[model samples]
Target: MEFPCDDNRISIVDLPEDCLLAIFRKLESDTDRNSFGLTCHRWLQIQNFGRQSLQFYCSLTIPNLSPLSQVVPNINSFHLYRLLSRFQQLSSLSLSGCTELPDSGLNPLQYFGSNLQSLYLDCCFGITDNGLSLVATGCPSLTSISLYRCSITDVGLEILVKACKALKDVNLSYCSLISDIGIRALSRECHEIQAVKISFCRNIFGIGFKGCSQALTFLEADSCKLDPEGILGVVSGGGLEYLNVSALSSCIRGDGLAAIGAGFAMRLRILNLRMCRSVSDESVVAIAKGCPALHEWNLALCHEVKLSGWEAVGFNCHNLEILHVNRCRNLCDRGFQALRDGCNRLSVLYMHRCCCVTVTAIELFKYIRGNVKIKEEELMYIGPKWPFFR
Candidate 1:
């Protein structure tokens, strides 16, 4: 059968560009997207220029993508503001781009400043004090802001606390320019600050938490330069539920951890002291006795905790479900009994790379606690994958 030329008839490629984009976004599979792109050069162009299927960003999906930024280095504020005007009630936005979204790029945030509740900008070194000021002034209602590896100093942080008093969560990880002054400023004004992450912020001595101590629930100060008093100050509030002080091996000791166990362990749930070489049996015993409600604990690389600590954990932390003692040089078969006897509800155990714990001991432990799941997962360099994080 011979078909007509059909030159005059409209084809699938002739669908309006916006309609095509909408259809492309609806596609959930990579194969389908690839097939769609192969239809014609026009669709390919659209797919190539835009961010990967924003799927009509329900707000905060890193819209106006990095590819476009790479293509159009200086995407002026006019076009960005105009595009954002569509999402009138938008309350969240994630503008992550490596060097593409400089301080000038954040200028468009002024439009969504009032209703914006959350903002995430990571590795945006271009964002300085001035750009922060712009955001702070516009988004007074902002409750959460994550600025990872930014170049903001205490001056900009002060500017932020002065404006956003209702802030509840802030991540200043790797922001080296900020010091205790910024923390003190936040403590003074940001009374609602509930969660704070100062990871690698070596300048923070931990004195500033006193202001929001009553409201603080989550604090991730891993690898920070906090001494014993600083650790005490952070947990003294007793309202904390999750705390991560990993890699503070040289700065933290048993006394600091014991303080948390003795006084603030009532509400404490998840504690990560991985790589704290100084944490010994006494600290572990104290924590286990006090924080009976502890759900998950990570003691990886803590070589100092001995059989006593494991025994104490089993005796007290009946609710302990997940335990990680990976690479514990001294963890042996005898210690496994303490856990097997006490933690009846223990569901998961991670003993990867533990040289002292024999295979027969593991088999015996498994035979007894058949309901518990055991896995030997070596530590990977992956970023922290916890609930409070991010």
Candidate 2:
């Protein structure tokens, strides 16, 4: 922005930093602040940093204007667009709890949706397949979207991917209606998607991710009722850096789980299998061989894994930094010794109610490696007594 006079001229860009900051302080509204930032990249950077000292938004105060959620039902598309058009630089929109906002409420997005890159509709129960279609049609530039607990099925998912090819991160957790069919659509169509969180979506298995093999890195799909084949499908991509398939119980077969360490282990850094009761030493040893680069491992409540497994972890996974083996019933002092001896880089160790591990072993490890942070509790109170091989 430039101010011109007959003899002299000055630009907003030429103003001193202090003058710019002083001028920005007088503007209170988010829209005004947003407009101030859009003058140039320098002003945008300054506005973002300066907001910490002089801020805007309703917060706990009275709504300066009608809250967007309250006006959803009554506001017409034209009025809504006219109101939202004030903030020409709006990039992130969160309507996480507008439970009653029907599909028509999304019509306003079409008018000013190009500026939006992230949309969060978590727990919006009224957003059916039709509503998501509106979102896909309106917000073509959306790179990240969360549909947590939304009532959308495969049709809605198919519609979304067909329109928004730039989607990189999506959250479908607890979206009970979605299944592998919907996921396959996402996998095949959205080539740029890197993170997919599908926790508690029981119908989906790892097989749907077969198409996201090239770019897939982070996957968190805990308690999805995965079977043997499903477990195998999870590691099939092998490019994953962080993987969590925790709480997978009775349905998964031993051989299927063991194969994760044997064949599919790529450059995995973090692996979480907490409460997976069927994880045996075979799987553990195979994991040690397959994923020697593991940095953080959580085997909490894994009663089936014994000393051999611990020994393998110590000998092979030298890069191991943090470990959680709380309630591992059979892991004794020798098992602890293997970890103490081999995992020199071990920094954080969590062991509570590991009854078979005597206090002497813990004390000795502390004496040897004083830097290793340990989290433990007295086991005598609740640990199994001589009645069951204490």
Candidate 3:
């Protein structure tokens, strides 16, 4: 028995060193570095230089660890902490899905303190205020932090706000533990803070975001327990560029939206109220009158709004690019006519399950040579069937 081998072979030495490095950088995320390290001795040498900044969303599981153990030492908390002490140039970190890490104290801080600028602990249930305090105190360069769905209290938040005064963006979405007191603390202390996301914080009962020290650019809280006063607090803040309050769909009818429109008339850009079922043309007109600078708006499934509201949006929001009005049963051909005529700049429009639109409306699309000459390059309609009925 004999084995045949190809005589032709490419020389790794001939390739430019920089070219080899580019390949190594791209392979950094391939766990255990097997893809690049096993390629050749030259490839293994390229890995030693280390890339600029390595970021990982999931765990950086060690290869030698068993399937049951993502880290060394058989899933021990202390051992896992030791494993993370190796990353040197990690500036940004994302741990969106890790729920096993211990959150009682700052056990993870020692590994993260060196050069971290941004940290995302979204949905990491293992962490508590103590861990957060460690982050605020240890990571001096920290500018942005997200604690989405993390269990946190006013104490933890107060410490973070007080310690990380340089912080700019903080996302506390779905942290039900927070209330008006925590928000007031954030507003009073975090002066340099620019953008704060506080969606689904149901405990924020009556207090408004009136005393916030910094100007807010984005605010979102859908399907959380909040009254008219809470809604008014955010609208009165006035520096909002993006706003979403679908949770208060009924409370923020025409009047609330009108107030938001009037307050954020200059800076408002994106608005999303997918299930704001009670919002009618009254609020739509108010928004059209007030928020002229809107670029993208989503009123998907808003039942009460009539066709006239679409006309107001078409006529006023010239810079509008994306619109999602799916399931607006009351919408008619006249409203679409306004949308086609006034919303000439639209690039993406979603009109799924809209029963009022006729087959004639489908022809109106630029592709069908209707009056509205929207470029074929744009436009996206959902639902099946020709002419898109209902």
Indicate which candidate wins on lDDT. 1
Q: What is candidate 3's local distance difference test score?
A: 0.67
Candidate 1 whole-model C-alpha lDDT, 0 to 1? 0.77
Stretches of model 3 off by over 4 angstroms after superposition: 1-77, 108-114, 205-208, 211-215, 235-237, 247-250, 365-390
Q: Write the per-residue lDDT of candidate 3 for residues 1-390, one digit (tens) a residue.
A: 955565555566567879877766666465855566666776666654443344333443234555565532223346435534644556666656566655643455555565777787776777788887778777777778888888889889888878777777888888989888888888777676667777677777536477454367766666655555665566665676776666453445554455556544467778777777777787788888788778878778788788778889888888887788778888887887788788666777766777897867857655532433332232232212211000
Top model number, TM-score: 2
Which pairs clash in model 1? none
Each prediction's RMSD over C-alphas, in Å, is 7.6, 8.9, 9.0
TM-score of each: 0.78, 0.79, 0.72
- The stretch of ten residues in a row with the least summed lDDT in candidate 1 is 51-60
Where does model 1 exceed 4 Å of error?
1-73, 98-100, 379-390
TM accuracy, model 2: 0.79
Q: Cα deviation of 248 in candidate 1 (Å)?
A: 1.7
Clash list (residue pairs), candidate 2: none
Task: Report the C-alpha lDDT of model 1 over 222-302, residue by residue, as the tens digit.
Answer: 888787667677777778888888887466766567766876657887888888888889989888988877888888898
